[model samples]
Target chain A: MEEESQIPKGRYAADISSINEAHARIKSLILKTPVLSSTSLNAISGRQLYFKCESFQKGGAFKFRGACNAVFSLNDEDASKGVITHSSGNHAAALALAAKLRGIPAYIVIPKNAPTCKIENVKRYGGQVIWSEANMRSREETANKVWQETGAIFIHPYNDGRILSGQGTISLELLEQAPQLDTLVVPISGGGLISGVALAAKSINPAIRILAAEPKGADDAAQFKAAGRIITLPETNTIADGLRAFLGDFTWPVVRDLVDDIITVEDSEIVKAMQLCYEILKIVVEPSGAIGLAAVLSESFQKNPAWKDCKHIGIVVSGGNVDMAVLWDSLNK
Target chain B: MEEESQIPKGRYAADISSINEAHARIKSLILKTPVLSSTSLNAISGRQLYFKCESFQKGGAFKFRGACNAVFSLNDEDASKGVITHSSGNHAAALALAAKLRGIPAYIVIPKNAPTCKIENVKRYGGQVIWSEANMRSREETANKVWQETGAIFIHPYNDGRILSGQGTISLELLEQAPQLDTLVVPISGGGLISGVALAAKSINPAIRILAAEPKGADDAAQFKAAGRIITLPETNTIADGLRAFLGDFTWPVVRDLVDDIITVEDSEIVKAMQLCYEILKIVVEPSGAIGLAAVLSESFQKNPAWKDCKHIGIVVSGGNVDMAVLWDSLNK
Candidate 1:
């Protein structure tokens, strides 16, 4: 990885400076979510852990940080024309609220099969939802058409610098809350959150171990890191819908250079971890948010002897806007 | 009411000073749980609300506050001999953990039909569980026999002054977190939590309106408040097992004198409220805890013109140690 970094071909990856700018821009718009210690998870994982509870954030997900930053960073003229994006749920709701706050129209292209609760949330936030077929091509085409027709600014969910910076705010809060933290475990989807967190953590304390967790079904980041290149999946399958994307060009280098390791967890393990979070922590965590804890509890990283020396760990609980029916089925299983 | 207070016999009632003393004594042992603001509930109820999340306390309920105070207040010889109590679930777990912390044996007499999860928690905390028939007489007889044989200190779950004072710690924390709160709502079960909260809130700010929430199916507290005397229920038939007891003599006066009003919510309303808590707040609030929100959301209290002036309202989320299966069922319904 260091050898690859020596090459001058890759774009200058995200750094603490970019994250700091993003934090300053989005601070007033987004909540400073708390870092809560989980005694039960600590006892089970044998690692003193702090959970960055982004589930308590507005729109019940950390996506709001990125959405707000992306929308707010837009030029006055561009923002007046409004913004358009494609998402299953969280990003749409986040963008809607962020745009609404700026008195700008938000056009969200969502898959026809998106959960009702999320769709309702987007509409409640005054976003215009344009339904697309349950496929990425349809979603992209719909969003592009909306952008072209309405002349609205296109906000890529994870590929944009502002999004990564906004996501990095989680690390800023975590490091401030627990300065002694030696390791950070963040769930990776398109590498946006982890990329930002890695940059922030490494910048503050270069010795900090930045780990990435991903569902096995959506393990594109792990494969990408292993191949030393960006990898896209032909198809995605996971209960953690928020973590189903492949890494973008912008996100790849930041994750590649900053993150120490990427670990994958089975969907069953993710569900079981979610159950434990609901039972013991009394907090509802979507499947993606539970993956980091799942990896630690399953001892996936224990093979690395350096992990044994880790004194303090922080895990980002990415989101909690889950459908109750789906949660009920998962709990029963 | 003021004239009644002037009577010599009624003047000796427990007040805020006693509640404050109890709070001071237990402040070190109990958790100062967070006060979570709800956007969804606020919009629905049209009231600025803060949830005093006692559900996050150690032992997963407010019962721990009372249990810890009761157990620790015991004399050294009595503490060494251990403590025994009879409860359906929350009280048993609370007493077990509190006693375990003191390195003393805890004998808990639970009904045969107690949830397996609660029983497991009791054993996990090193408490000895003695099964009794699922009735008041059988539980009392079983606890008495164990106490007589072992010379264990008997810690009454709700009827004791020490227990009531211990529960008052929640009010102290709540007011400290949100001192500007104009109204405080709490669920009533044998009037322990509400009694403590009422006394503490009255002591802190006499103008703060203290409201009691009770399930319609088990409205013993409501009846007691209306009749100006304790009213025993013919049968308890609510999912809120934590709020199914009759008001005790010590608690009755507090409810009548300190509590401004008593409101009732239906079982279905409680289930709906729990679903909302899980879906919106992402917190696992037990049915008992949900009842206070249920009263506010269902307009049971809102219809009262006096409540319209309440600028800041505080609700005590008393417990969260609910069975996953039960939560699943409630969410599905």
Candidate 2:
């Protein structure tokens, strides 16, 4: 049961207690997002689905919970120097806003080729933009240079104990909100979210089932789980811009050992799920956010005998930072 | 203080007690929709706004409240025959669902020109659809014919006392959810929603202010308020299809004596609010539902001396039954 030995020394520190501590630490700093359901959706899926609407969380995503916890966990000396991160996604904006609340500067290393809206989001939150080339190597180099120059703490988006523990708080809230939940469907990217979720949920209710949803175009997590090792892809293709990252050392072991299964879905299925969220649930969800719903409604999940008795399902709706113009254009095509 | 006498005898009968009874009668049948708020929206509007999200109600609108109340209030003899209504909007679908739940028939007289989606909604709810000309006269005649054929009781969308009383339940829930609310901004259509809101809110707290929002394209409510009488427009226009109807005898007295003011907004403003709801609030609201937010953010309300101190406000988001294909087409154009 003790998986701590599997992780490298002085790394992968989060556990159920740490997650509970994270909840206590950041309780006042984040919004307790609502759990929503639709009767019509229930009929279609042949199960009662409770949607944990993290889309309504501050910064328009659940990223704020982790970022806020990570920023606040710093020592006085580290806090005085502010924080730094490399992300062209929700984490960049979340970290910026979190730092702003704590009255500290945030250095955000975003690729130059990143969308204008994302760049604007970081700037709107008072984050100092540090442009890098359009690749992970350039982004890390730029962030490292900023950390060297400013002595600012480097906050990993999801591959850190502090970050994942904060993300784990969602599981505690989810279980409390719907105690009858027998299964949790979460979208897998870098595995920070599901790592935290699996730890917290399994610790709380040992009988609970954890399923990971992955984009078929970027099924690195599914491959890693099957191969019993991490598999980093040189190229990834998917409309889910948020779910392209490979699992880190901190997240891989938890995902590999704890996840019940990984379900990969096509881009078209994600689009259909997004439309359903918009039309039936009356809630907007980015492609990545819609993955959990897509997984729940997928043919594999519906027909699989293992998941036949999983009647009460909880879906983590992770984010809603979509570009409407781009989404509608793609949808029209 | 009694306004019941203003209505013709044997016509309007709902009061605060009747509204309370309606709440008890239909409480088990409908969802208690959430009251949502946004910090950025509050900062932009310079007031704390609580959105009473009736869009999450049954049948995707607050019409279910009134329809359910009316359907359930019938005696065994009257209820066995079923119910009838003439609507091509949220009310039609709401009535159909309400009747279906009671194990009775629902005869929905819809205009021939009604959108395919709306027609589909009624049919999906097991309503028997009767087609008539697009005009109200023909629709009414068709509904009358259906009523005579089946001996079914007629359920008006909003004009009836029972319907308004059922709608008043929103005020009770909203006030309890946000006790600090000093003003209620409601979208005015046939005046049922606002009239019920005003009566209940004022009864609960005499100092509470009630403001009605009307689309300038179909600004009959504003005109009637200014002229001190009902002013029916021969040809009404507005993208907010739900707000085109005039106030009825049962609702006029409530609006005339209880409502503080009626604010008319441009279709452009309503569209902007709809976009804001989609982008910022992550909620889909029809044009009529968005009008309350539009009115609150309007320059007239922002600059008005009378409402300057009205800080804690509640906006009724009336519905979310939108045709996204049509909406996207118009937006693209």
Deviation in Å, model 2, residue A107 alpha carbon: 1.6
What CAPRI grade goes to candidate 1? acceptable
lDDT tens readout by residue for model 1, A235-291: 878878889988888888888877888888888888878877877788877788788
**For candidate 2 chain A, which ten residues in a row score worst on lDDT?**
A2-11
Q: Estimate each model's TM-score.
A: 0.94, 0.94
Give the runs in model 1 whose Cα sits over 4 Å from its true position.
Answer: A1-13, A326-333, B1-15, B326-333
DockQ metric for all predictions:
0.47, 0.43
Inter-residue clash pairs, candidate 1? none
Q: DockQ for model 2?
A: 0.43
* Tens-digit lDDT track of model 1 for B1-333: 542243223332345555667677777777789899876678888889999988888878899998988888888998999999999878899999999989999999999988776787788788999999999999999999999999999988887888877888787788888889999989998888887777666766768898888998889878877787865559978878788888878888778877888889888788888878887787988788788899887676878887889779998898887777644444323
lDDT of each: 0.83, 0.88
Error of 1 at A108 (Å): 0.7
lDDT of 2 by residue, B153-179 (tens): 999888898899999999989999999
What CAPRI-style quality would you assign to candidate 2?
acceptable
How close is chain B to the truth by TM-score, in each candidate? 0.92, 0.94
Instruction: Tell me the tens digit of each residue's lDDT in model 2 across A72-94.
Output: 88877889999999998889999
